[model samples]
Target: MKNEDQAAMLLLGVGGGGCRLAASVRAVYGAGLHAVGVDTDALANRNAAAGGMTCLLLGGSRLSGHGTGGDAIQGRLAAQDDMQNLQAQMNGVRTAVVMACLGGGTGGGSTPEIVKALGEMGIATVCFVTMPFGFEGQARRKEAERVLPMIEESADSLVVVPLDDLLKDAGEDLMLENAVNIAEGIIAAGITLLWRLLSKPGFISLDAEKLHTMVMRGGNALFGCGSAAGDDRAIKSVAALRGCSLLRSGEALKRANALMLGILAGSDLRLAEVGEVMCEVNKSCKPGCHVEMGTVFDPAYEGRIELVALAFESWTAAVMAVPKSETEVAAEPPVADVIPARVGGRKVRSKGGSKLSFGATGRGKFKGVEPTLYNNQDLDVPTFIRRGIRLER
Candidate 1:
């Protein structure tokens, strides 16, 4: 597959918080893409480089000390710095995607700033970020609560993933690495959808403006399978998805491509039943077309069965690659390669270890919140959080 549009990927991370995220993006999508690291802490730059992000900078003000007084001020200043830098990067790219850990030091703080800058420059921005797990603590939660709204308000479209909920299946025995894998899987799933629409041959290849429009309209449409208590079986239904409305909304699930199916089962469901459900789902789709099947289950539920499906158009589908070897390379250094080796920038610092004083600022606001995080309070509780940019409220 070959991509005709010039796309630039900006990988932002602060400290080791963004390490796995940056690494995950590289692991799934390889070289010829630019990667830049940003952090006020030197460690973040070092780790991002190790993770394969080429550019690392220390533009965000470093967080020091403790307590939650006016610490938000420093965050606002950091956000401002991030916005300035991001504006410079949006120079020639038609599409820009940023992958970062939302509840940490650098990435968390500067992400909103960058988004605001891009928004002002008319560049489309999509963010893939994780919230802190409930068990982390209040500090993280407060931090997340404070910054998330600010960040969400600035971006064209924001996709906030709740890792704790997504990986609950990993169970109590899960390790940190396992948690990371789960996060990456969620990230991969989100990006893969976009990649399919833009990179494939049959789907629509969206530009920055169109991308931004969809994002502002709540870009992602989610589907999941779940079973209820008392049902001792798995249910699979074959339904043809007929339409092209989804693709127009940046969802990319049309009728011409293979159908997207989902499965859900309860504790009582037998292995045979599960097998039968999957087989039926596979057979329900159009022949000779590719099908992407997703599944989920809960052992505690007594009797439950769930199946979901979506479709995509063939003409608008894309299967293109970065075309690193063929596309004419840019003369200037790619944004990914510009992150500093160490975390030290000309950004302002706070007086006390806990906060900084950014002379003056403005108000900030987000039109509509996405379903992934903003609308669900149960999911909104910040498991982790770090501060960044500030603007007019």
Candidate 2:
């Protein structure tokens, strides 16, 4: 990859709420990294540009009728579509940092598809998912659970950031915008570290396939830290740990000959969680490797855990490297039904798979739910051709 494409950022807006989150990051850091956003919504492109980043709108709806059978098929199609769209957006970038909010419509439904496509091309894809608070109740929970596995399965590494957790000590200043801002800060810091490490002397190019394999096997760990409670001492402790871990990580990268990294949140976490995160990261980065650190706390503005970071190594690479057999595919339950569901007022068929709803009882029946467009319509020939031609999947 050339210098222009070496450090790139791929932002995928999966759900209704994801755009705000993606926009938040783009708003803060303009131009240091190449930003590309994808959404099923037609407004996605506008939203991305408004946020000060470049983007592509896949133009679709979020609902696909419980994501099974036909929904799954559509999901695959959407994934293919996204890859094709993204291929043109890609400028031969070496490392791609993917950010998307989890749960909700497009981000949740389509993220896995994008990952699979990029992984096939040997590109390292790291996902940043903003999980809803349990307070949002069941609807969000099911969304998180459903998408979690897909994100894990498709990406090189995934860092899950719980929105509710970040708000624990947010004080009066905490709001959706501020929360996203915080998350973006943490994410930016994490990605910057990874980029710096990769650009350092003695670092060689890492194959995307190897990187993706390492992340899929749970070879990654998450850590959260923020000073929502105003505890600077505790915050510093976490920062110290992260710093040490980064140093060791760089060392490990040199020895293992690891190539790429995926960063989730730039900010949006507490300070106290850093050390524990680094410790866990070191453990996962190198199975038997150990890193030492200490912790501290403060009463005012208590530091807490908020963000998650991922580290990869040879063992993880090996786990991800081994290909799954056909039996492996058949053994697991289908994520959703394959048949399309009939949307009322139009010709639609139900997709088959397990149906899980998170919110409100009596709102709709889980079984035989109508299929909503990923953006609310069937794939047009031009769009379909675009995805097929680009992804080549």
Quick one: best TM-score, which candidate? Answer: 2
The whole-model C-alpha lDDT of candidate 2 against the native structure comes to 0.46
* RMSD in angstroms between candidate 1 and the native structure over all alpha carbons: 17.2
For model 1, how does the per-residue alpha-carbon lDDT over 1-393 read when each residue is reduced to its tens digit? 423342443444433455456566556556634445555555545566676675445443444322112244554455565555645655565445666565565556666666566555545565656667777777866776677766656543455555565566456888887777765764554454343333332211224332322333333222222222333334322221111111222233422344444443444556676565556555544455455444444352346554433333321111211223324433433223222221111111111233322222311111122211211111111121112333457
Per model, how many backbone clashes are there? 51, 67
Candidate 2 off by > 4 Å: 1-20, 60-79, 169-185, 192-218, 226-235, 239-393
Question: What does candidate 2's lDDT look like per residue over 6-75, in tens digits?
Answer: 4553544443355555555455433455566666555545656676766665534432223322233454
Q: When superposed on Cα atoms, how far off is each prediction in RMSD?
A: 17.2, 16.1
For this target, which candidate reaches the highest lDDT against the unseen true structure?
Answer: 2
What TM-score quantifies how close candidate 2 is to the native fold?
0.52
Question: Each prediction's TM-score against the native?
Answer: 0.51, 0.52
